[model samples]
Target chain A: MSADVELQKVSVSFGNFYAAKNVSVKIEKGEFFSFLGPSGCGKTTLLRAISGFAEPSDGKILIGGQDMAGIGPNKRPTSLIFQNLALFPLMSVADNIAFSLEVRGTGKVQRRNRADELLELVALSGQGNKKVHELSGGQKQRVAIARALAIEPAVLLLDEPLSALDLKLRQKMRTELREIQKRVGITFIYITHDQGEALTMSDRIAVMNEGELEQVGSGHNVYEAPHTPFVASFVGENNAFYGTVISTNGDMVRVSSQGKDFLAKAGDLKDGKKHTFQKRDKVIMFVRPESIFLKDQINQADNIFSAIFKTIEFEGNLKNIYLSIDGVQDVRCSISNAVETATLSTSESIELKFSSRDAVVLPVGPLAVD
Target chain B: MNYFFNKNGPLISTYLIISIGFWLIFLIIIPQLYMFDLSFRPNIPTLLRGGPDDVYTLVHYKHFLFGSETSGERYNYVDVRVFLDTILTAILITLINLCFCYPIAFYIAKVASAKTARLLIVSLIIPFWINELLRSFALRILFAGEGFINNVLIKMGVIDTGINFIAMDVALYTGLNYAYILLMIFPLYNAIETLDKNQLEAAEDLGSSMIRTHLRIVIPHAKAGIASGCTMVFMLTAGALATPVVLSSPNTFWFTQLIYQWFNMNDNWPRGAAYSVVLLTVSVVFVLLMMKIFKVKIGEIVR
Candidate 1:
């Protein structure tokens, strides 16, 4: 059974501080939706609100078109998997998976059979009789998922369940979780601070900051065309330039930063409108590191700047070349390993270029804190 | 031993070891060994203590099962009844105390805010500053014929006359429950506090009711604390002397009182030693049985 969840202007406030403020969104049934944000950004709080552990200070939550006001978590048709999994250590694996059914007065034989079925579904067959502690960390995670699914909840809410696993295991479980969600055909609301994870697993991602939704769209749409400066800076590495709008034409704007004029594509304003920036209106322009190319790589571009190379950071497949333009903004240029390496020493002058279409200019606002 | 020496230096280590040795030998081992020896021997005159008349016998231990025929009693009805009554009453007190303290412990550890929890802890512990004897006496006054509670009930027209708490053994039960309640609350709080709050929320999210949550998740997690708390409370209530004496009516009899009579009033140390050994053995066995039933280990409880 799957149910679409809708939040109508929901706000969760703790006295003067709001954990989530005026959030309204509709999650489609059988879709993998993720709330992606940094710590203290209220993503987990919003997940808890849907699971009924946290009541909205204002507004309503509807599941399957039923209002959830005054309903305790036990009565809600949603299950939550905690960050730590919270499997009963004293119980066997089968018992842990079948706890919800047991509490609902299911017969022991049926419970065991259901538990075994779930174990095999999670690719952990014949591992039900062992104690919970006897399982590995990933095994415990599957057991927690089985326990949550045993209730046949219309929605499954996971609050960073793979955060505890190591990098390799976390990556493996990400695909596993996505596969499980598809097989179950239920609405899955995932909460995470990892942008890459959100991009990889979610059909649609909601980017949140300071208790408010910054942007909600497909992963490709968000990364390529972010609506806010926070989303542009937070989702991935970007070199930001502070300047004022010199002129506006169509959907492109020319901005002057540090005695230099640059042409850039104008993005939507904070209010989700096409903002036509007036002359001398303060704005911040963002360009992704990968978009900036070495002068030799791209012969001609709309924007070109020369800077002294500061350093080059070596990754396995790519290299990040950091440079300073007039000692003002630190610019980073990421190049693939397949490209020819620039034979330039530190402090050497180099030319960098990027197209105006690849750069986005937003109204000056709060950037994501590192 | 070597770690202690390195940690504290040889001089301080020697002093600590000597102190522990002296305590174990003189205070615990010697006294228990003496009592065990005396329980197997007969009570005789001092002049014939080492003589043939002072022989080892099973008479003292047998006296517990079969009464002294000189008193014309068919069985040791008074002592045996008192012993059984003590065991049953202690168990009841433990169950009642568990019911009373579990919610309070859960509240302080999980539900209450930090400030409220601090206030509650201070309130619960402040009453324990007074000596146990004084506390028992205070309870006696609270349950007296013209006590504060009875007086308030009468003035409020809730009762025609004051209920006899002492006559009904309510006073003793209240006294014992009050005396060992802190012992139960702290262990339970410690265990329940270590539980991740997510587990409780997880159970709730999985459609488990509040009562079932406790039955499945919370109580099992806190079993170690419960086992330790119940063990301490049961032993303390069964061996209690001052509270029962001060709060129980004349008709009530405690097993400790019979042992007191044999040792002090009758001046029969052998019989008293036999009764003491029996009570200690039974209490230890009972605690072990409970631990087995609950499937808890001693290491877990201590942790």
Candidate 2:
């Protein structure tokens, strides 16, 4: 049931503005792929292009080695669950589920039998006679999924199907969706802007920004080692420091900023390529907040800084500690509140330390870091 | 009870009761009761019959069903042919209007640009400003023998001689029928515009052909509008008197024209009232039947 998709440098433009510019990605068979980005980032546009709703201006889209240019949506063996569900309100639950079969001219008894089978598959048995409006939100979502799957298309596309649900239902539906994808073993191409949903449900996520594909990797890789600043800031929370590289060795580099020097691991930089810093060129270092520990508990590190506590916020599972350094703006550090009592107070001075491996030295550019 | 008689409550109740009572007495309840009472009375031997206390009898209804005799003259009563003609003509006009309006309404709702939609809507409404009689007369002048149409046709060498365009049913079909056609198209356009374009695309994506998509989705969704347009055209065309009088000959007299003849020309108000009551009854029944067949509420069908 799974089909591999290859988009080779595909670009879709509407007259003047580009929706997806030179985006290229290879999705493996049976992989749960998700396009994760903010709204208007062209994630849905790319999904629509793959579903043959919009033709690309340049480059080629291949589904299992078949060229997809000039193919109408109906001709392609792809099923898309729309954002609004689009269930036929006048039809019964069984009829909505059996729509694909009925359109294919299946007999009434056979269609009803198949609809009942799919209902049980979506855990919605005996719901065939119920009206669509009578179902709960979660049941309606499942009915949409069952309807899309009835055709047994090679690729199943979903466009923010859980966005309209409440928070608890959205979270619960995420698990159900992932489980269903696994059971069906089909290539599920999900599109959403929710970072948590993508990370939890996708086997591989393509993070997009401003109509461009930034990075595509597993959720762990995307969160742990982001290649671009946009990916780093978009995927999860991190602390960024502005600095300049002072020197470099085989695997370590020293960066200086505001009368302070810090050590970082050298990565992917060639000797002949133009480096952003030799002695005074500006650079930025990004470090995950959890990687920085309070100095008294630090046993191993290459960079350490002392700061005065400015504010402390008590979240349920974690406490957010805000600190102010002498030459830097306020930085936030998240500490797990495993115990009942608090450790630090406002205006108290504390030391924070991080290892060289955790600090990523990025080239300084115009893009701001959060 | 004291709260019910409070300032805001009694004020609102008084206004509501007075307004509703006025409409019920004058518009619907009183007029229907008067017509019912008038239908049962006998005509007096006078030049004009006025007021409701003259006589009580079933002679008017019996005369409507069977031929009747007055003091000095004999009159043919309402016949089955006239009733059938009214119903058949109403059905034909409704069907013709639907056929003409569907494509125009679909174009205005779906295909035309926003500016074009506004222009078409304005053009449809402009004819209403002219009096119906004046418009029908204007049509007569345009389609009569040696009128503008025949003159243009002859000058263009399409015909060697002038043709009597208004002497045929074509005049009734093209002239007065178009007003009801415009009315039908407006409601259809409103209903069709509410359809979701994405749903159509979804249907196509699900392997349904273009024709099937229209049949399964578009037409079913436009059911309410179709019912409303048909009802409006049928009711309006069936009861119309002026258009037929101007465009059609004496033999082409409509049912409403027959009712007018009994009342004014024949001076038999009771028989005319009975015919009017029957016309109203048949129109209401047909509208209700259509609403039932479409499985839509009457309110939904009209709007």
DockQ per candidate, 2 decimals = 0.84, 0.59
Q: Which residue pairs clash in candidate 2?
A: none
Q: Give me the overall lDDT of model 1.
A: 0.91
lDDT of 1 by residue, A194-236 (tens): 9988999999999999899999888987898889889999998
Off by over 4 Å in 2: A266-277, A326-328, A339-341, A365-370, B1-16, B45-54, B69-79, B106-116, B141-165
Report the number of backbone clashes for model 2. Answer: 0
Candidate of highest TM-score: 1
How accurately is candidate 2 docked according to DockQ?
0.59
Give each candidate's fraction of reference contacts reproduced. 0.88, 0.42
> By DockQ thresholds, what CAPRI class is model 2?
medium
CA RMSD (A), model 1:
1.6
- Say which docking band candidate 1 falls in: high
Q: What does candidate 2's lDDT look like per residue over A139-246, in tens digits?
A: 999999999888888899999999999999999999999999999998999999898999999999999998998778889877776666677778877777778788
